[model samples]
Target: MRDRIEKRMAEIAVIGLGYIGLPTAIMFANAGFNVTGYEIRKDVVERINSGKAHIVEPDIDDLLRKVIESGKLRATSNPADIREKDVYIICVQTPLREDRTPNLTYLESAVETVAKAMKPGALIVIESTIPPLTTVRMAEFIEELTGLKPGRDFYMVHAPERVMPGRIFRELVYNSRILGGITPESAEIAERLYRSFVKGQVFRTKSTVSEVVKLMENTFRDVNIALANEFAYLAHQYGINVFEAIELANSHPRVKIHVPGIGVGGHCLPKDPHLLVWPARDDFGLIRLAREINDGMPLLAKDLLFEALRTINLPPEKAVVAVLGLAYKGDSDDTRNSPASAFVEAIVDDVAEVRTYDPFVEGTHGSLEEALRGADAVVIATDHTVFRSLDWETLGKLMRNRVLIDGRHVVEMPPEGFVFKGVGRGEY
Candidate 1:
């Protein structure tokens, strides 16, 4: 089986062609495998077939075009197209429910689709971010659906994705991967498949550990960012700049501190902490606290905006505020659980009007001029590179009032004639 896969005879079907799935399918196809992308959205399927991507990521367009033009990759909404694939990889989402529990609805659906199509001796891999023991439970689920026992009749492995949005393509090749399988043989086979394209180390472990490792990586970042956010709050009370203090402290070799923003966002950071703590035996007090701190950042930003408004003697109903960015983080357009979205939700009803603009995000204002025109205040939600070098003088001229709120702390201080306030900076 390994030899056949290495020889490019194995057909790989990647289910759910969203952020992770699309790039992954493209990578495998570029590596000489016959790849089929299964998507529930017909528009996504059509776009990929037409060599266009539905999601925005850096350098994916040319890669998608090359893979499609090479005849190695195609997408379909029909499950029948994936019935005979040699390898089945489930890349669907595993988001949290409203109660902050692990939502396995999408994962279960993906498993059902694979169960209907998979044959004996076929390898099944899950690349979604799920809680510990989910891979084993999914393996049991496949057994109950198809009456095929894992490791004997079929293979199962958990290989959660570990790439950020903006650098997904590059990290997919270079990043070290964790492969946790139900059995040693399952791990070995999946390792061979990933080794084909992965330039970094492929570490093998039990399926549960791989799940925990993925959660741990994201949770660590979340906790650290939460600490930074707390520091920012403390700095505000002390009337100091948190960025300067963080830089000076981080100068020590071991004291690395993350930057505080309006809030933590994106699909992973905001939700993964909950996944880690939801199933744990203990209450996970620290983890819960960290989530709360990060979650409160949007409200903190709202307070800052209101304070700026009061300083200028403008009422909420009379303020025309412009929100700068909507995507969770910088450059790329992935807005899942975005802090900018929360900030907008928190203040949209109170403000006279809220205009939004993002350079890379669609359905926003056509130009910055439109969003900033006649606005009394502008909130820099996401730290997109374009937002860093804005001509504040010219843009401020277009606004009715000159108030700048830097939620991400990416903007410089005291725009010559404008009233400026940043997340961590005390006063200016």
Candidate 2:
């Protein structure tokens, strides 16, 4: 069945070639599908046409280059080329608004574009994460625009892209896939499209269930981190070691707690929580207390930093604060909704002369030594690997003071004068 479907879907049109889209396009092309990567950005379209990728994803550059060379992949700002493809995958952005509401503008626009050009019996897959109702509504819109009932004339499915930004290439083909279609036929077609390349299991369900599953996956991580962050705060107050506590707790068969940190950040984690909260209050007549708890974390980290400075008899505004790591996570340069960025920006705005160092971000500071120079205090907000490898003796010498706030519990200290603080590690 899968092989027969693969023979049917010879061409795939991937819309909105951002981080997820480009990589998906390349993966499909490498799997021998004729892949057309569509983007409205002229520069991006031209870059891919010239066998280059604008977005930074692992192995995508080489794969795109190869597939393009093999006449299996192409890119364009135009949709006429896109209309000819049998499979359409939407991978646009679904961000939160300034008011913290789920913003679906990019997604709606993608749907409008795809609806206008898609042919009969074509399979449409939405890989962008969205609120549960989004896929069903998009399917309705496609029916409305294409003048064809979803199950009969065309098929649509939601296979929310589960690929992490840094690990996109491997996860695209290796991680498990979910298929939620407007109809069972749509789901079956979507499953075949995925099975052509995906070695991972493709579970089948309805569109709304798949939508919530994607959001739930990210929200679960956010909620876990929130617990970790709260414990980190409590540990700071009690002078306990959180890393030790977490390690001890993990000894239990089912007590798998997350590591404490300054705050939770990243495009998905920060945004998905809000999506659930807004629809709960507005659409579903429910309150979002847990969401608020997680959302309050960045502020809590900031307030803790001020209290830490006070303990050392330093005014936060007067202290030269150094921030270690600006990316949301270690070993990657993506800063979209980075928790560290939020924390540092708050510190910069509220009360501090903040300097930041990230090995991934070149030219921000020539070296970690340069970023931490003359600091009255160092706030290890992001757990980049280089921060862990820092020579503590050299750090002590370079700093104007010795108060080290290990927001991520990544620092090792000297016994004499250094004080370290991490969530739940209430001892340092």
Candidate 3:
């Protein structure tokens, strides 16, 4: 199996061609493997086959086109097209339920598909972030469906992806990977497979530890951001700039403070913490409280927007609010678990009108001018790089009322003649 993988003779199947799956397939294909991508969305399959990327990421289009033109990658909607592949990499989403439990439906369905299609000696790799013990349970589930004993008839490994959305292609190559196996051989085989393209250090451990490590990494960030948000609230009370305070505090050798924002967003930070604590019997309130703090940040943004309107003597129902940036973060099209969406939801019912403009996201207002024209207030949500250099003095002329609310701290200075209220800029 190692020889076939090293020789690029192992045919690879990547299931679920979303943000993670498509890029993963492209990487493997560009590494000289014959890769097949399976996605239920026919439109996505058609788009990929034609060398176009549905998601926005740096260098994805050029990389995807290279592999597609070389005949190394082919995307398909049919299950038969992926049958009997030597490698199966599942990159499906494991979103949280409405009640905050880890929803494993997508992951399970992908596993069932692989179980039905995989041969006896195929290597199964799950790149989805999931609850601890899920990989072991999944191997048992596959055994029930395929009657193939794991680590005997087949090998299984939990190799969670550790890349951010904007820097996915670059990070996929540079980021250190953690491969957790149910057995020693499973980890060894998966490491060999990824080392073909991965240039960063690779670590091997048990499946459960790998799961905890991924969740812990994100959870740590979430918790620290929550602490930063608390500091933002304190700044509002103390009538100071949290950013300035954080800068000075971070000057201390041991102090490293995270910047406050509207909320934590993206796929991992918001959801992985919940998945980490969901399966545990009992957890101290710290993790859950941190999640609540982060979740409530959008509401804080809403409050700031409404307060700006009140200061301008405008009622909430009469305000035409324009929200700039809808994606979770800057320079990316992904909106899963985005705090911007939550902030919009919080204000959509109260505000007279809400206009959204995100350059990378589709189905938004065509231009920033269009969204701000005649709007009573403008809220900066995503902190896109372009937003940093915006000529606010000129853009303010387009608004009906010059009310600027910086939800993500995009505006460093308050423009003259505008009622500005930023998340941690209490001096405004």
User: After superposition, which runs of candidate 1 have C-alpha atoms over 4 Å from their true positions?
Assistant: none
lDDT of 1 by residue, 8-122 (tens): 8899999999999999999999999999999999999999999999998888999999999999999999999999688999999988888989898999999999999988999
**Position 224, candidate 1: lDDT:** 98
Question: Please, what is the TM-score per model?
Answer: 0.98, 0.92, 0.98
The CA-based lDDT of model 1 is what? Answer: 0.92
Cα displacement (Å) at residue 410, model 1: 1.7
* Cα lDDT, all candidates: 0.92, 0.78, 0.93
Candidate 3 shows a clash count of 0
| lDDT of candidate 2 over 203-264, digit per residue (tens) | 99999889888888887887777777677767767777778888999999999998767676
Displacement of the residue 195 alpha carbon in candidate 1, Å: 1.0
Model 1 steric clash total: 0
Stretches off by above 4 angstroms in model 3 are none
- Score candidate 3 by lDDT: 0.93
lDDT of 3 by residue, 1-428 (tens): 99999999999999999889999999999899999999999999999999999888889899999999999999999999999999999999898889989899999999999999999999999999999999999999999999999999999999999998888888999999999999999999999999989999999999999999999999999999999999999999999999999999999999999989999888789899999988889985999999999999999889888888989899999999999999888887888888989999999999899999999889999999999999999998998899999998889899999999998887888999899999988875
In angstroms, give how far residue 65 of model 3 lies from its true place.
1.0
As for TM-score, the candidate ahead, 2 or 3, is 3
